[model samples]
Target: MLGKLLKHEFKETWKLPVLVCVLVFAVFLATYWYLGNIPPAASEDEISMAAMMAFLLFTIAVICGNFALLIYLAVRFYKNLYTDEGYLMHTLPVTPRSLILSKLILSSSWMILISFEIFFTIFPVMERFFQLLSTDPQISLYTALGEYISISEFVLLVVVSVIISSISSMLTIYASISLGQLFGKHKVLASVLCYIGFSAITQIITSIFMTPYMVSYVITLDTTTAAAASFQFWEFFRTILWIGVGISAILAVLCYILTEYIMKKCLNLD
Candidate 1:
């Protein structure tokens, strides 16, 4: 039953994600073609300027496209599960948990997919820019990545963080929309307000909890104390990563419970 719900949800929601990816890929290819053709005889300064401008434009497009996709997903979730269409959803022979899980899984998958698409799509442009700088054109992506940290650990951390963050974000929106259902009128407006309120509260709580550790970490690096002291950067980063994961996991669970309770017990379909 859960599988069927997921299949249906994916089928309905895939079009937008696919469309966004296609458009982003098209832009990336066009930009790459235009920029990669710059003649070697062009002044180095001029080439540098053009490369920077092209990178900026490509980055802006990717960011905007990703944000638009997220907004579309959130709107779809609200419309499909909270609007008049919800009348059909609630009547389906499925548990509230299953339905919510289906949406969560699909939304998180799309978010992760879009994130990867944005990264890989722009990678060629970045590679070309590096080449123009007379840097090692043979540099592997992993070699560039190694300058930061252990690639495997960092990649794992990133994947986990993205998944958890996506789930947390979608669940927050779901919970907000569920709360808005309590209103008898202007439910969409109410949902928007709830989302803002929830985001503010979450931000405040996160700042209170995470700011100290982050500040301490920054101070250590800024003063060069980390080098003098027996500080392990990887250990510190891993701790922070796990802390964030824990917080996101807890929030995701709470939002899931809230959404499930509302849909099952207090759904306002009128």
Candidate 2:
């Protein structure tokens, strides 16, 4: 039953995800080509302006793409399970738990997919761009970043971070929307307000929790101990990363439970 639901959801939602991926690739490739083709004698203003425009487009493409996908997930969930279509959906043989699980699984998968696309699509092009900008034949992408960790470890940690954060965010929205459905009217508005509140609380909590670790890393001494400082920074960063990952993972589970409970016991698809 969950399998069928996932299949149906994927069939309906694939277009936007694919389009976003295409747009990201196109934007990155266009930026790469433009940089490589810049005239040898181009003015500083010209180069800077062009590069800035490219970067701005790249930023917009990545951000808007993911934002659109996230909103689409919420819209589909609401329409399919809480609106007119929900009448038919509820008549299906599956339980509300399966319905919610299908949504979460699919949503998390798409979130991870978009994160992967953004990281890989921009990395190689940006790597070459940096090397060209510096005119250093030996300048590799790993030159600065490899100081504290191997590329594999860096990539692994990045993927782990993305997965945890993405699922946490999606589940938070799902839980917010589920809770909002209980409202007698203006459910969408209620959902938006709930989301804003959730975001605020989350930000405050995460900040409070991370403050000690952050301060410990920041209060250390001066420039004479550059290497030591860098090591301290890395330790600080690792601690922060793990802390964030832990918090996000816990939140994701709680939100999943909240969403499922709402779907199962408090659902008011009016």
- What is each predicted model's overall lDDT from 0 to 1? 0.81, 0.81
Clashes of each: 0, 0
Candidate 2 lDDT over residue span 140-232, tens digit each: 776766887677877878989999998998889988888889999989999999999988887788899999877766676344677777766
Candidate 1 lDDT over residue span 93-168, tens digit each: 9999998999989998888888878777777887776666554457565565575567788778878888888889
Model 2 residue 43 distance off true place after TM-score fit, in angstroms: 12
Could you tell me the TM-score of candidate 2? Answer: 0.91
Evaluated at residue 52, the lDDT of candidate 1 is: 72
Off by over 4 Å in 2: 39-47, 132-137, 225-227
Error of 1 at 47 (Å): 7.5
Q: Give the TM-score comparing model 1 with the true structure, all chains together.
A: 0.83
Global CA lDDT computed for model 1: 0.81
